[model samples]
Target chain A: MDRSQLLKGLLDIIVLRVLETEDGYGYQILRRLRAAGFDELGDASVYGTLRRLYRAGYLSTYVQPSESGPHRKYYALTEAGRKYLHQMREAWEDVSAKMRALFDIAENGTAEKGRA
Target chain B: MTDTPQKNTDIADYRIAVERHLADLPASIREDLLNGLEEHLAEVSADLKPGVPLSHLLGSPEAYARELRETAEFPRENAGDRFRRSMWRMADPSFAWARGTADKFTGSAGVGEVGEFGRTLRPAWWVLRGFIAAAVVTHIFIFGNDSLREAVLSTGFFGLLFIVAIALAFVWLSLRLGVRAQEWSRRSRRLVAASGIALVAVGMLTFSWVADGFVYYREPVVGYSTAHDVVDEGVSDVYVYDENGELLTGVYLFDQHGNPLYLGDPWSCDDGRVNNPFEQEEQESAVPDPFAATTEPPLDEGRYGYRYPLCPVVEESTGADDPEQPASEPSEEPADADPSDEPTETPSRTPTPDPSAAD
Candidate 1:
């Protein structure tokens, strides 16, 4: 899959899952997404998303000042965010299953045409 | 493969970026996120490489932050709260009052030159002053000096008292009449009607003077005298006759010659039809010529003998020590009375009746 295209709706789940394992700041979260092969992710969208999620109550946030520069803000998934992610995962499974079934029918039909 | 911890320096740089980007966000959110990020950096930094950047491990700041974006949950928009704030901003008290004042100035009657109330009042005041001046001037001129002096003097000698009283009356009348005339000016068909009233008063006064001088005083053959009379050096005896030449009444006049001049009765003058001296002959002839054969003359309009003419008696010669004869007193009796009451000789002196009392 083109990771950039496939990552659209998956970033939220991915970020939530990464934060679930351990609380992280924006850069750490970005590293995890890149390791997962989503190279096209943009910084504005990620930071904006973090703020939006924090405002929505899915993520609790905190800031710690650095000796070298300005402060850093960290986000951690809430229980609600975890529960929501689980539901989203289940929904994704059901939709993928339906899509796979449709594709199977088309491939089987085309294979019979070639034999003919 | 990616088990290494992020460098402290890289993490710190990323935190600064995030903090800068989120500056305008709500105070609580900004503070909380900043604090959390700082703590996360401390934890991530200790085992990290001295030179290896966080960007090398995280792909890039753009990719890292983007991955966080799709999952973030934002608060619901509070439209009602925003709307209330906007309404409060709109409700400026001074501006509202100013708008109301402007509306009233435009909407209310009067206050401006073109306003209904002012329009009415201005024209009316103009007319009222004109009318009052014309009327007062007319009255002053028609009655002339005598009546005015009498009327003013009769009021009293207190100047300030009368002035204040008149001023008060003038103020009250001006207010009332000014208002009324203004109203009429607006509604009347002819706005100049007020001028007509003033003209009529002036015309009437003019008529009075003209008629008195030219018509009343100048009636033909009628006695004329100044308001005062002088007793001349007089003959011992005097008498007055009527228009019919009958002796009416007289006092005595003695000449300077110490002689009584039995001057004929003072009241008789030549008897004939004397034309009205005040009227121009052309004006007189404009009436149907009595001499005209076509005229059916009216009985009362005919010219007749000296209609109650009066004459003065004087000695034939001028001399000293002439005793002045008392002026004749106007009789209260009818003008046509017979002159038989004339006394021919001097009578025993008795207390003369007070002249003013007789009047």
Candidate 2:
């Protein structure tokens, strides 16, 4: 399955989860995501996603000026965002477990037909 | 650098579109976006194959504009919505002109009689002071040389008047324009009011000076006549005078038939020429001397008397018993007259005595 298709739905959650570990700039975050094997993320698309998540109140931002280059706005997750992420995580796990059980039943029924 | 003029125009248009796109983002975001976009365009152009349209190198300007519009609070289209969006502009921080005009009126005329009276009194006093100062100066100047005093008094009086008039005109205009409210402080209002009062005061003095000059320059003449019984129409004589009271000329008064009546100085005639300073030469010249003896018919008695029509005539007198009695006399005249000579009571004569005048 292509990760790009699923990436849009989980982008806010992913951003919050990433920021939870360590605060990073856009370029740094992009590099980390790429290293973790999500290369399909477009540079503009990631920035747009970050802005949208910040506007939605899941993330907060502050700018730290760099001596050599330009300033960067760093985003961090809030308490409300952490609670939302946890709820989404639990729901996703429940759905995955239920689907697995249904697949197991179907597999068992097909094996019984092959034996007969 | 080697691009044709058309290509240069195209590049400028592209730069404008890209700059507009970048402006939608925050300042921290915009700078990098602009540099990155320009670099992307340059890289894409360099890597392009021959004869491709440059349009492919850029996205739609509208789409980029839409992204920027999402962040900032653009003015709303509907009037009410726009008003609502800029509600902060209506707050105290913004409405200074209204508050300033209101706040300035705190210690003004309407506040109380003491404050208002003080303001009114101040202007009046200032005016009085100015006039007194002008008068004292004028007195010293005039009394020092009686010959030059007349000229100095006349000119000084008129000069003070002119200043006062101009000041009054300015104050009137300022009041009409509601100028006092615009002053940011109370002190300025007092200064304006004081000066304005002084001006009106000086103006009054100037008027008196003009009157005095008129008296000094006025020429007097003799030979007066009283209007006796209706002096009939005709040209008559009247005399003119100069500032020194010397006779200037004999003015002629004429009837409608062009006849002259008692001719001499109008000022000297007590058969009395009408005192109209504004009368034209023709009106003065055309005045008929009713007292002049001529062939023309005489004016009726009504035109000649100190008339109170309700006044009791000799016949109306109750044989001079109470000389003050009026209404009881005129009505009773016909009753006492010889009945043969009289026509009893005529309808016109009885009602002709105006009831209002009797009352």
TM-score for the A-chain in each candidate structure? 0.82, 0.79
Q: Give the winner by lDDT.
A: 1
After superposition, the stretches of candidate 2 with alpha carbons farther than 4 Å from their true spots are A1-3, B1-359
lDDT of 2 by residue, B1-359 (tens): 22344544554566568577666466755554554444333333333344443466334654544433342222224767657645855675656655555545644636553445455565455445445544444544544567865554578878567546645654455554334334546667667666656755665765677786664333111112332211222212322222223221112222233222232222423434543222323433776433223211222212221111111122222233333434444445433432323233221222223334323
Best by DockQ: 1
What would the per-residue lDDT of candidate 2 be over residues A11-112, giving only the tens digit for each residue? 656666777888776666766787888776644445555565555466677777755334555778877678767877787789879999999999999999
The clash numbers for all candidates, in the given order, read 37, 20
Residue ranges of candidate 1 with Cα displaced over 4 Å? A17-51, A61-79, B1-47, B58-359
Q: Looking at candidate 2, what is the lDDT of residue B183? A: 55
At residue B164, candidate 2 shows an lDDT of 63
Docking class of predicted structure 2: incorrect
Q: Judged by DockQ cut-offs, is candidate 1 incorrect, acceptable, medium or high?
A: incorrect
Give DockQ for candidates 1 onward, in order: 0.14, 0.02
